[model samples]
Structures are given as structure tokens and as C-alpha cells.
Target: MSYSNAQELLSAIQPASGGTEIFDPATGELVGRVAQNSVADLDAAVSAARTAQPAWDALGHEERNRLLNLAADRIEANAEALAELLSREQGKPLNGPNARFEIGGCAAWLRAATAYEVEPEVVVDDGETYAAKHYRALGVVGAIGPWNWPMMISIWQLAPSLRMGNTVVMKPSEYTPLSVLALGHVLNEVLPADVLQVVAGGREVGEKLSGHPEINKIMFTGSTPTGKAIIRSSADTVKRLTLELGGNDAGIVMEDADPKAIAEDLFWGAFINTGQTCAALKRLYVPESIYTQVCQALTEVAAKMPMGVGLDENNVLGPLQNKAQYNIVADLVQGAVDSGATVLLGANPDSEAAGYFYPTTLVADIDPQNDLVTKEQFGPALPIVKVKNVEEAITHANSLETGLGASVWGSDREQALAVAARIQAGTVWINSHGTIDPRIPFGGAKQSGYGLEFGLDGLKALAQPQLIKG
Candidate 1:
């Protein structure tokens, strides 16, 4: 079987089509079908997770770390297969620059989680009482993931939670659930039965997982609206929650920065992964001094890139993963054009042939208050807003409802640092965007959602602290 769809994968377990369809956007071919998960299935996965969690949690740090490392090794060994599944299902360029890196990064995160050297610092003062703090796991985490990067996102949800000793019941986006199923197969080989189960279905499946009495924690990465709903449902249990929601990140190019360097940062931040990244640059604010030059340079760069399969090994761009997103990108771009925004570079869907792919688009004259600037495009559409000064750029970037990540471009390290301090996002890059490493803590400051993932801190988010005093 070539990993067609969720239903096909589930066929080995049960009989039913489940009413979900999976297609390859590049070819519009039905890759797989999924069985709609029912309430019974939810109960089963949760029960299995709950039953196995205690023993898994009982293992020492070394034992747990070993298991996690094993998973990372497997992922590294199968990077190509994983990347192909990811690109085929998500419609990203095959073997794209970032896809495989993301997989490798997942492996790195696992090792980092294992090697986190955090010892409880004991305080010995004049009148100090002895106390030692320790962190422990919250069993049975319910993870609701998005479709953009299913494998990496699933690893994001699993690596730390499992490292911390919590079991997982993941409900991936319906459109791209097959990758999760594929992931589950890899996990089952190393993990005990029921430690990590991919529960298929839709909103109802997620609802059961979030509201299930057995679930101890809920970690979700998806749209802001969906995130809010998950929070509301988890309130009854107050299930330990971690959310990495949508982002409308901005790139600020200061007047002092090199236009060539700034344009390169803008291009990758706004166009990589077909610009479907949650934290990829969606809004760009350029210094007025070099606006035209920057725009021309960005246009030239965008034009040279090709779109194709994420597994094709040669294609650099790919079609949008779904129809709804294609429409969203189209509407936002067309709206910008209708409002007198200049098409620095791009093809209007109205003028294009077919498929869900959009050209690397550059839209200028976009008001800071416009919908295109304020919303998460989640596509390869760049809306540049030229600002008079860094102060205005900072002001506008902080206005959005999401704040996952942002980039600041300039040569003055101190000045860029000072400007970066003012930006409301949690992760700010001085001269780069979408450059994440396992050694750092990653999360959003505002509505981009709470709870951190990656690094020693990432594992800590899944742990509970207990003070042991003598």
C-alpha cells in the first residue's frame, strides 16, 4: 500500500470509509480515504493511552530518553519517506529546502529534550530551609494538530510529551490525517501498544478527546477560532493545555538595513513552504527609503522560483493543499489588487488556469489596517507596507491578533536588538526568519497561543513540579 488515505490505513483495523477523502493537490488524485472516527474509537484510544501511561511514566529519565532517541533515529532514517508523505499530502515543493530540515530538526529536538541539563538549584542561605523541586509528567495528552506540516507537527506534539512520560491521543486535521496514521505505525514499533494512537474523524473526534475525562492535558496547533473552542471544552477538566495557534508575523526592514539582504529575508520568510507556514512572514513592513528597490528585488527572486511536489526532488514550489486555502489566498490577493495595491509580482487566480498553487505574490500600497495585512494568509502572498520609521513599523506589527514570530533586518546589532525588544512576538530574528533550532525555546507571546515547545523548556511545559523537602 502506498499510504493512500486514512480509511485505507484503518482498513487493517476496521471496516468503513468514514466519509473523509484525501487528494493530491498537485494532481487532484485521490490518495487515500479515511474512516470517520466515532465516539467509540475515541474511548478506545484514550483507554489505551491511560492504561499504558503509568508504566511508561514509571521509567527512569534514561530509559525514556533512550526510547525517544530511537524514534528520532527512525525518523532520520526515513526522512525521505516522511518528507514525501508530507509533501504529497500537503502540496509543498518536493524535497524543498525546509521540509527535510524540519524532519531533521524534529530529530534534533528529541535529542535536546533528552539532554536538557536542568538540575534543581538548591538554596542554602543564612535562614534557608531545605527544598528540592522536581518535574513530573501529566499522563494522556490530547493533541489536535493542523494540516500544513503533519509529520513535524505530530513529532512536535509527541516528542516532548512522550519524553516527559505522557501518552498521546492525536487528532490531526481531517484533510491530512494519513500522515498521522503513518506516524502512528512508526511510533508503535518503538512505543508500547496504545501509548500513541491516531484517532481519525472530524470536529466531533477532537471534541471527545478534549472533553474526555481520562485526558490529563490538551495541546492544540490550529486556527485561532478552533483553538478557542478547544480551550472552552477543556475548561471543565482544566486539562493542562498548550496551544500553538495561527500567526500573522511581520518583517521590519529598517532604513539602515541593506535592501539586498532585507529582500532575501523577506522572500524566504514570505515564500518558503509555499508561504503556508504558521509563522512564515505574512505581513512585511519596509522602510520607505528603499521600498521600490526592495520590491523589484523581491519580485525578481519570486519569479525565478518553480512550484512542484515536495517529494519530486527538483520542484521548488507546489500547489495549495486544499481548495479552501486556495480560495483564501486568491481572495486576499484580489482584494489587495481591487483596493489599488500594486502587483509587484504574481498571477491572479482569475487569470490562471487550474490547481491550488499561487505565484510568489508581492502586493504594495497595502494599508496596515487592511484585511490582507491583519489576517494569516497561510499562503505565498506577500503584502508589503512601507513605513516611515522603525517606530511606525513596530507599532503596526504589534497590532495583529497573532504574534508567533517576526524578523528585524539591519546591521546595527544594538539598534536591531532594541527594536526587536519592542516587537510583541515571542521569537524575533535579527536578520533571518523561520530559522528555528532545538536549543531554543519557541512559542508565541499573544493570541498566537500559549505554552512553549522545543528545548529543555519545551519538555518542562509537559512536566509538573513537585517539591521534596527533608
Candidate 2:
């Protein structure tokens, strides 16, 4: 069935027995429903995926690549309708780093995954003997995608696994399952039955899926706490896991950096997807010498950017995706204020507002010990802390338990690169932050979770290495 909107997508889904209602975060209105899939449904999906795997694997890499490209083509064809539904459910603005951008991202990643090839590596070629290392598909990949950037992140996990010939049973976040289900619908047209299935549900379904003995591998993108739980759950079955978890990523601005030149980049880096992005610049450390100037420059830029419902093309920033997240951002910012941090721009949003709309906020002169500085406020608020020097900035940036991404901004590229090396993160940027390429590998350091996504390493992560000897 073709799904042009949230309701249409909802109607197309035949969720197991029970399900939960979904709402539009931008309007606080009931938009659709998702199946609250039970453990039985989870088991059934795993069984089907396991049953489907060998046939998919037998298709070989070239055929797999062909089908994945077809799926990508279908995604591009349905991009407009998909983007509208994504905006409605995800609460990201229609323009300016919103639904269209995410849908485009999905197509790009799928196409990129098609181009990536994991050919057998010849280890020996002596006249007497020959040996090679070949990649083989793992069975029944269970992918759990998060609500923020739901479609793209799901594609991040789904594309590589399918391209490597693994059948997948995916569980998208209940908050944003429609877009993923709609995506599944589009792909189902091009793929074999049971090759790519989306099961919508809450935590119970996810936990069951992770721990299922039938599932050979689990790929999850969500909170670190939840990642830890999944790791624990998979221990009994010893499932291969790839986790892309929570990140309170930091961005450091050097004394030599031009505040005006970097202001726009810094603002978007921190506030993209309404700052719900896992790899977004959560905390910014600027040199004390220019910290005030940086804050002023960012504030000026933010003031011109519109914030409202996602459907409005004029809005660059939209509401927080849910009430729970909105509360977390509100409380953290308030706690910081209570401890004496100055609000450089924006404040606690009106609680009674029609939607969970938190303003693009910048908190200044924040104490290093404050929760706002220490915790991940995954919303449209950023805390700016002043550092004595690059060394101190690196120290503070690396101090966090979570290190998914970090950035060093300065006029001198060499100096910035030097500092970027010191920050403990999987991806470090010289002048930009949180910008990712499909060809580059991305994961986390420390508690940010493990296993790489994207690139050749990512493709190999989905496969087993088989060494052949003569």
C-alpha cells in the first residue's frame, strides 16, 4: 500500500494483537497508532528472519547489491510523501535540516552501501598452496532504531545488513515507527517476503528481540543505558552487537577562532534536529578570552531563525519529539539557571504551549559542575563553558563518560587538528561538528557504545570472516 501521510501509513500496518497510539509532537494531536508487539510477535519475527536468511544469503553479493539499489530507487521515488509523514511524526521542520534532508539521507546511505564491496582477501598465493579470507553473512539481524532521525538511522543499520545478505527484523522507536513502517512498505515491494520486516512496539519487544537466541546479531541505536541493557540481555545468547548510543558530544572553540565566521556552523551543530541528534554538539567549550563574543554571535544568529511546528516551511527549529524529552531539557536548563548560569538567549518555554516547543537556548557562564554542563540535554538548548586554554578545553571535552563526537574550531587548521586529536571521540572535526559521511566509519568511544557504522568496516561488521586454506 502507498502511504502518503501518517494516517495512511497507520492504516496499512497490521500490528500483532495490541498497540499504542502515536501523536504529532508538533501539534500534540493524535496522529496514528503503532502495534505494541508482544514477546510472541518478536519471536515470530526472529523465526521468520532466521528462516529467510539462507535464501537471501544464497542470492550472492551482486544480486543483494541490485536489490538494495532498487530499494534506494524506491525510497527516492517516495521521498516527498515520506518527508511529509516524517515531519509530522518526527517534529523536525519541513525545511532547513528537516524531513526532506533525512529522507534524502536515507537514499544516499543506501546508494553508498551498494557501492561498498567486501571482496575476499587473498592471504597466500604460493604455487604449492593458496588461502583467502572471505566475508559471509550473519543470520537474523535485529535492528532497534531510535525516534530521533528514525528513518536515516534505521537505514544506517538496515542497508548494510541487507547488502551483506542478512534478513532483518527491525523494531523502530514507538514514538516514530510510522515512517519506518512506511519505509518497510516501500522496500517490501523490491525485496523478498520476510527479508525486511518492521515490528513496532515498546521496550518489551526490544528486550525480547535482543535476548532472543534465534537472532544472530543485534544492531541498536539509542540511549547508553538501554544499550547496556541490551548488551546484558544478549550475553546469554552471545549475539553479535553494534550499538550507536547516547552522546553528550562537545565542541571546543580556540582563542584564535572567529566567532562570527563559526557562529552559524556552531549554532546548527548544537541545534540540528532541534538538538535531538545523538551526535550533536551538546556542550561547547570556548576560550575565556573570546567566550563572551562567541555567545553573542551565536545568539544573534539564533534570533533570526524561526521556531514553530514542523509543517511550516518558515520554521527552522521544531518542537521536542515528546513530553518526556521536553521535561528533561526544561529541568536541566532550569537547574543550571538556579545555579547562576546566565541565559544568553532564550528561556524555559511556555509549558502550556500547543506543542513541546523549547526555544533554541544558549546558557552562558555555566559552572563545570552544573548538570546542564555535565548531562546530555537532548533538546534545543546548549551550554557554553569558558576554558583557560586549548589544553583545558581538551581536558574538559574528554572528561565526559560519553564521547561519540567532538570538534575543535580555530583559524589555524594545524592547531585545530592537534587539539582534535586529543579529544576522546570516534569522530573529530577541525572546523565542523556532527557532519558525517556515509563512506566514513562512525561509532562511539567510552560509554558511547561500540561497533562501527558506515564504510567498509561497517559492512564487514555485519558479516563473518571465513578463512579458506589449501
Candidate 3:
């Protein structure tokens, strides 16, 4: 899929923006170029949205449901191509799996949101009914998504906002903007262009869109520091905000744990997406009894994963999106080594041929207060801290500034659930890591960011109630 001609690339994109550069993670090749939105492009999109919105919104729930559902159908049709393109741009191992997960999950959200009952019922006082309640949309929602899972996150934003009757202007991360832009073109075919619009470019473009006065709300997913900055920027306008930030989630392994199974769970959970997830199980606390066995089992599993291009079926991991992440992961690994933490397996990634890849590293015996354990290292490096008992594991796991998600691994489900209950996070998985659901709400606790993205909880976030006197 080479775009030798500029016009061919131009036609592929719906609302093209300049300064967009595409790189093949496999060969580090220049795969494509994109023209980002100039001020004129932004004007056109916003005006088009402003024009199309009132009518789209006026059509009300039934029409909106039909249009959004059609958009979901279109997403299904393009699933394969989108997956391959997403892998080429962002470099996740399960290009096929990830793509399928995102598409299916997005459709589910649209379907769920369609059934959202925003009508008012009865909540009375004294002798007679004082007022009635109803929910209203928040106008245009400014959704800014991350590169790790752009398509899904965009749907995370779009599903709720559209259901609530607000129009959307989504700005995807510059590193992986193509799939999102392509979505805009697809939706235009199924639904009106105003319902879902994808606006792409670099940080400057994002800042402009996020700060636009017309935008009533902003939903973002990224690092805590960046989330704070975005909140501050949106503060002047006092935009409605939902920030999904960072996490150094802790996984607790009890003495009663089965070392072999726990080992496999720990590696995949903490190190999935090369350890790039915000809620990915990160710091691990293991009881002394099973420490040696757990370590040995994990070392072998980590060794089996091979890093290469995402398109390769057998590739276990792919490259980091860019050099900055590569350096970040590199330094974290080096720091752990200097802090008396032992690197049990693998080293800094050596990807001389293609993509920014990092080998999975399991570091043990580090002080719990060490930056490697406390800081949010979003990469394929797992650092383990030994704890005397489950109590200490619970305390240490909750010690971080961010609380996104965690896992409690043990043979005893009751014990794991009890320990998981003690850890402070939005979601805690027992005997597993990194499982998310559209029916169940997903978000973070504390600095991990606030607000839910899916399920009935998400519908509430997008809805507002109005009371009328009876």
C-alpha cells in the first residue's frame, strides 16, 4: 500500500491536515505523508459542524441512534484495513486482535448508548410532585485521545457524547492520526458529517481545538502531568472535563499463589502493549514464600516474546512509537539497575532494523520508594518489590500518586478478592490484568484521572437533568 502520488493520498483522507508524517514501525520507513488542518480547514470543519449539528440534534434520539449505528457498521467493514494501518502507525502486536477489539467494543458502545433512557420519572416531596427531571446534552464535546489506542478511545468519547446529543470534534494523537481521520470519512458516508468529525495535527492544533470557545466539554486520556496541564488550559473557559491519566498500578501476589500461573499473569498484564497502558499492571508485590518460583517462571515467559513489526504474525512486541519513549524506557531500566534492583531477564531493546522496540525486563529487589517502582514507567519493564505479607502489599500498592487499575493473583479467589479490595484503584482484577468491558464503566482513581468512559456510568457523565414544577 504505497501512496506514490500526492493526490492519491489526498483522496484517501476525508478532511486532510498538513504536517502529518507516517512511519512504518517495522523498517522505520517513511510510509506516508498527511496534510494537516490549516486555519481554513478548522474553520470549514467547525462551520460544517455548526450547520449540521442543530438539524442532527433536532432529529432527536431515534435518528441519532440510526446514524451512529450505521457509522458502527462502517467501522466493522473497515476493521481489517484499519487494524493493519493502526499497527503500521502505532505498532501494537495484536493489530488484528486490537483492531477487532476496538471495532467491536465501539459498536457495543453505540448500541448501548442508543438504549440510554434519559427521560425523567418521579422523585417526590411533601404532598405533591414539585418538579420533573430531564437530561440535556452538553453541546460540542472536545475529545482528545491518545496514540496507544486511538480508535477505541475516540469511540469511548464519541459514543457517550453523541448519545447525549452533543456534537463532537475529536483530535487524535499526532503519532497515530490516520485511522481517526479515516473514521471521519467513513462516518460521513453513513451519517451526516456533523455528528462525528476527526480533526488531526500536532500539539498546536490540539491546543487550538481544546481551547476553542465553542467546545463545551473536553475528555482526554494521557499522562497525569499532561492531563493537569490540559485541565489548566481548559480552566479559563471552565470546560467540562474528564481526564484519564497515568498509573503505576500494583499487582499483589499472595503466599497462597500458584507461582507458575501467577508468573504468566504478571508478565502479560504488566508488560502488555510493551507496558504502554495507563492502567497496565506495573509494580508487583510478592510474598516471600513464592518469590523464587514466581521469578523463575516469569523469566522464561518474558524470554519467549519477540519484538518486531506489528504486521508479523509471530511478533510478540513491536517498536515504541517514537524515540522519546525509547529513551524513557531505557533510562528507567538503567536507573533500576543503579538502584540495586536486579535485571532478571532481557535488556534495553536492540532494534537496528525497524521500529522502536524494547525488550521486556523484569527487575527485582528494588526499594519500594525507588522511582522505578513509584514513577509511571509506560514501557515493557516490570519491577518487583518483595513484601513480607499481604498487608504490606496492599499498603505499598496504594502508595502511588496514580490509581488506575491493579491485579491480585492467587490460587485462593477469596483471598485475592480481599487483597484486591484493599488496593485503591478504579478496577482490580483477581488472577488477571488488563481486562476492560464496555458494559462496565472504566476510568481511574486520584491522579489516574477522573470520569468513566463506558457503560451506564458513562451515560450519566454525558447526561444532565432538568426539573419542571408540577
* Residues 227-308, model 1: lDDT tens digits: 8888999999888888898999989988787877667667887777788888898888988998888888888778888776
Per-residue alpha-carbon lDDT of candidate 2 for residues 16-97, written as tens digits (9 for 90 to 100):
5456777889897776667666788888888888898899999998998999998998898778788888898889988998
Q: Which stretches of candidate 3 lie over 4 Å from their true place?
A: 1-11, 14-19, 94-97, 125-127
For residues 1-470, could you state the per-residue lDDT of candidate 3 as single tens digits? 33333234336883344455688665687656666765556656666666666776788888888888887787677666666666777787654335445656666766777775666755665576566667777778888999877777788888888877888888888787876776566666877666678877677767876677777788999988878888888888988888899888889888888888667767778877778877787888988887888888999888887777777787767777777887888888888888778889876566465567777789988889888888887888888888898899898998878899998888888878877778789999988888887778888997899988787779778766677777
Q: Model 1, residue 36: displacement in angstroms?
A: 2.5
Would you give me the overall lDDT of model 1? 0.80
Clashes of each: 15, 1, 8
RMSD of each: 2.7, 1.6, 3.0
Scored against the true structure, residue 167 in model 3 reaches a CA lDDT of 81
Among these predictions, the greatest TM-score belongs to: 2
TM-score of each: 0.94, 0.97, 0.92
* Span of 10 residues, lowest total lDDT, candidate 1: 1-10
> Model 2, residue 66: displacement in angstroms?
1.2
